[model samples]
Target: MTVGFVMLCHTALDRAAQVARHWATHGCPVVVHVDKRVKRKGYDRLVQALGDLGNVRFSGRHACEWGTWGIVAATQEASSIMLREFPQVRHVYLASGSCLPLRPVAELVRYLDARPRVDFIESVTTEDVGWTIGGLNLERFTMRFPFSWRKHRRLFDGYVKLQRRIGLKRRIPAGIVPHLGSQWWCLTRQTLSAILDNPERAEIDRYFRRVWIPDESYFQTLVRQVSDQVESRSLTLSKFDFQGKPHIFYDDHLQILRRSDCFVARKIWPHADRLYASFLSDDPSAQATAEPNPGKIDRLFARAVERRTKGRAGLYMQSRHPNENWENGRTAAPYSVFEGFSDLFENFETWLGKATGTRVHGHLFAPDRVQFAGGDSVYNGALCDSAAMRDYNPKSFLTSLIWNTRGERQCFQFGPGDSQKLIYFMAADANAQISVISGAWAIPLFHSNRNFGDIRREAAQLQKIEAEFLTVLRASWVKARVRTWTLAEFIENPMEPLQTIVDEISPRSLRRLSEAPRLADLTGFGQFLQNLRNQGMQPVLMGDFPATGAMPQPGNRRGRPYLVK
Candidate 1:
């Protein structure tokens, strides 16, 4: 019953008083860890509002640097101070100033009560994504500044950019795949005690000191390593954009905030009037069910698995495809592999365009085409191939497409399935004996603002990709490839706006012909027969979408069985 909140503050002084006030009524003790670099100008008002609540407040300021270990130092200070003061507190909920409690305070307590042994921490011992515990750990442990460090963050960002281009870790150490996830976590007293008493405290600190953004990984990592069962997901509410920056909250995100079932959200801007107003205790039922908006936070988490119409997988790894093509019918050699999410594709396509000297048409499929008909956010990232299934496993996203001769996509769609039949219609053997296809490559991803950079640059990349695509199209094997489906008829459903990219970007390839029940036809392109075409594009990467119509419900996993002939 000794549950307390460890509030980490950067700015947003106005909400502190409100958050403190809410927690006080819930009878949960509070501890504040304000960033030292920033001032506590608003504390006077916040204190006055609290009016002498027993909650304790500490005054050590934490100056957190981007992608650095200062974050770990700050959290360690907070935890130590809290433990010293509240020896009786069992669970310390780590949160930020911007995050607000979405659920009634009581419901959160009950949820914790049901689970006493498990740590809400997420720690993976592997040296892969989480670099803190990896072989090249020392390069980071030493206080060696490889890149030029500058006060101006953008310049520092420039340095980071340089490192990325040259195969170096800007903030994260070299060769160490840093484990990343939500910075906020809820930990038990036992776990906290173990972390404080860790025998390798000095050694651990040595590494974290150099590691970037250690705050997000430190406590969670330590707790995860010690705890038997650490939940991979966090119970907080916060969303980061494509560049890993937290997305500012606006009224538009209200639907996500309302429907999201989380305990808290963080890194909110100072002036989120609508967001603050929405949290007011207006409705009684809203108190109990309303917690962290699961919807808002869902955007930050990436899916790890992909299952299709006939999925049968346990441990899945990405299979790198060949950068060439295979022979087919009338078409040149059919493309043996798709350049998925790779900058190399940009180079290849551009080279091919130059080689073949024609607008090289290409296609990239969706990882889970059926799942993200409306948008990527609509995806649940999990699928069940059978209707009677009990537990539907989570999966990554997949996409598909048909492109014009310019290496630009004409239409795109997604559906889920497994590796077995993924390349059945037209697939080449890739590593792990899997058939990988291009999903969502012909759309925003290939030429978007975030990862792809300036639109003009993206266009240049597209031109290059076309050049590389020529090599595929000219191959004798690819000439035999057939048409899978008409672009217009392929993605007419409201669910898949991703396919709309095709309608807008590649108009020349498909036309709504003036023939019969449906005008969508490929009669103009008489080269390939429909019989030899792939039934549909396959999702080689993320989640596998079930063909026809199938999806996993929110918090529930079930789907119609794949009709196997």
Candidate 2:
């Protein structure tokens, strides 16, 4: 797997030369793009350092500016030159002059080799809640700004305010949803070719030319349209503060950097000569060793097991009503309980299962008895009316155990057996959901608004409970040789932490679970509710039981199932 590096640089030519030499030593070709703003003397010095390297090539200079379209242009030019010059290269990594490799080049090559079709690009939808940069997504695309705005900030500020005041908004070009991410990426040759050879490339280029800070968005949005093999993570590890400026790596950060899985870390200060020397050295110790840590290796095995067992396992989930409001008569919304578990199960059998090729037979059980009560009682609460419980097919051996006060304790007997694995899933947000439900259900005379501090304290207590639950579950599972998982982790990626469990138990075959039906069939209640929405009905049966609304008839070609009375 031959890899190529495209280094974009303005200053620190000496540092860039060091990086190029290091990469070249691994038989990887380097394509350097120097900004046209570099003075002739500096340009000559850069050439003098890199000219002797047989594998290094330089692209035509562009007058690159920070956060502008010029940066995109520079990268495109360098990538184009690299692809044309070295047709044998399989993957191309985009980096900057001051960035240093975190792992050995051989290890990085192997990592890429393992996933040749995947593009290591960190991308998120532009409107994501966590992307909290002030006016960046809005102003960058909407306002027409020049590169000189940095020098004449006040003038640009006034212009932006005036544009927003007048209700001026630029429409993003057709067929593009805005995506923002780190500009650095490692892309496969197929993806690169698709990007370079796109039919609408000219239109895209013209549109982004007027966009502010297009470098971070341009390639990110466009490449995603071409390939679904994109991994929403960058191979470069970078940290930015509140203002979005990258943190400069210092000598003190060496250990932290060494531990990262990232191929590179960037924005090294020019004064760190010793640090630069360490990266440029030929000694093996200079590069982070690729030896697998025992803890990490264990986790890898668990993930492998998770991937292997997906879609074919049996899931036994036991959830208690959030303990915070147990004394209060207020109960969780019947639909919320149905929806949350439906989502959890649907994701398990459908999204996560299909994504990992594992399907699970889900059996959910919620106890009927009130907390602190000693005797058996009917579960006449919202759970009884929940579609999740009512629609479970007992004949299929799929069970939803409600109305039994001792069910949760008794269900532990149905642990992993006969080559099948059991995963226990619970929601971390159960307490918060219960709190909101209780507050909403409060009588008008007794209602009291919770302050932010109160909410924070409650949340902290809930999180502690959640953590302790996991810790105890983990210990019990370790002792019993069964697996335990959280709803949040399953929804996100269950494979991440499995390696440690796998390491400890060292199962003969990591594979667990059996082939099962599709998720659409498994989540019958969810699909029934969704069909209700499709028919323009508001299906709200909050305090009511048995979901006695008009259920769609089964075998409806539209894929809607009728609710049985």
Candidate 3:
């Protein structure tokens, strides 16, 4: 039996064929199942977009309604069609339209050819790894979904009310042995054939009939009960959103996606076209990252300020008289010095919103700043009135980054081989909020060199983003609240390097330890500090200068935009 690609897309008719084309070009048979809910005309257009595919065939239509039995009907229909039309088709890979092929199809075929006996589906019944959001949903299971009542709106409403009354709510009931995992699966031909031919199949189908959102759980549960060879992990990268939406909208949470290194990430928005294109391209360096290219970020900086000031200049124009006599520094000092506590609080609050990730409530003089220096003042010039900022409530100072009650003593510091590198969070805002932040809820740039901020160009890119954010502030006259330690401050009030830094004090702190965690690790505080002192960054290297036989200067073209891969 040969491995075949099976695409099960609900409404994305036009997009399915993109993946089909990828598979078909490699001589792999493609089985497409367009949702029956889609219009025939749209389906026809999808077929037309497919162009000529000698090996690919549409696996009939399926009307896959969410939280309904229609999805099961579609999957079964597609599977049956696949078996009848292509008897030689072996393993069926369940994929969706949003999926993109990163590894070549030939590579996939090669991988499967190398592994014949093992099924790639993850079905371990682990409590922590992946479990159905189960509880009393089983009552929805006890009765086989009766199609006759599906259209009976009154009956459905009553059924839900009764379920809730009987304590049969949504939680997965104790010891129900609930199974769950990614809907996508790669099943062996023999297993799939057995499932198809089994006489007990009707019983299995009936059980799944009443299952809530059976599409996701049916195959996962059935596969778990059917085989022990199932791996405990799915190869597909499907994002589950908070509202039960199938797609992830990564406008603000783009950082989260970057952290999840699944081979493929998806359901990207159309607005992210540049990033989508570059990511799917054959080259990664040229990827349209959200990084602030000085040129690109600069353009946005100007445009943003323009929009803020557009048609609104009148609001500020009347404030000052153009020919008014200007005050000397002595006359201006009174206003600056006599500014009320309320004004100072307002200024801190504004900066807090822009930079700090901590929330401050009910307090005027709550000292929100934490200085990790000798006496204080990273920059003495900026500390003119900061002397009074000492003796702050420590609790208020240690609450950002979800570190409330964790105590400042419990707060750990890290260095990533550069004096300036320690200032990464400042780029996002003021104070590497993740590192130096104790209070004020806000996202500071380069928060920490720990698990966040990469030493790669990403760090530089983050700086660019924060710089861009700052430029916006400067244009709007928003004062930055946090200031860095000055050379004098470091000399007069230098604090000991954090223990995390001490652990890595060896290696003469000269050579870069591979990646991080070691004293020589670029991530270590000492190493990061050293890098800043030496004016070095995480080394970016060029790979594989394609031999002249293949191409000219191969590595150079691919070098500059250091791809994560």
- The prediction achieving the highest TM-score against the true structure is 2
TM-score of each: 0.48, 0.51, 0.46
Ranking by TM-score: 2, 1, 3
Clashes of 3: 38
Give the per-residue lDDT of model 3 (tens digit) for 56-124.
Answer: 777667567666777667777667666777777666777777665444454456566766765666553
Candidates in order have lDDT scores of 0.47, 0.56, 0.44
Residue lDDT tens for model 2, 57-122: 999899887756788989998999889989988999999998987777887888788888989887
What does the lDDT read for residue 194 in candidate 3? 65
By the lDDT metric, which is better: model 2 or model 3? 2
Please write out the lDDT profile of model 1 over residues 426-451, one tens digit for every residue: 32211111111223233333233354
Model 2: which ten-residue window has the lowest total lDDT?
A: 432-441
- What is residue 187's positional error in candidate 3, in angstroms? 1.0
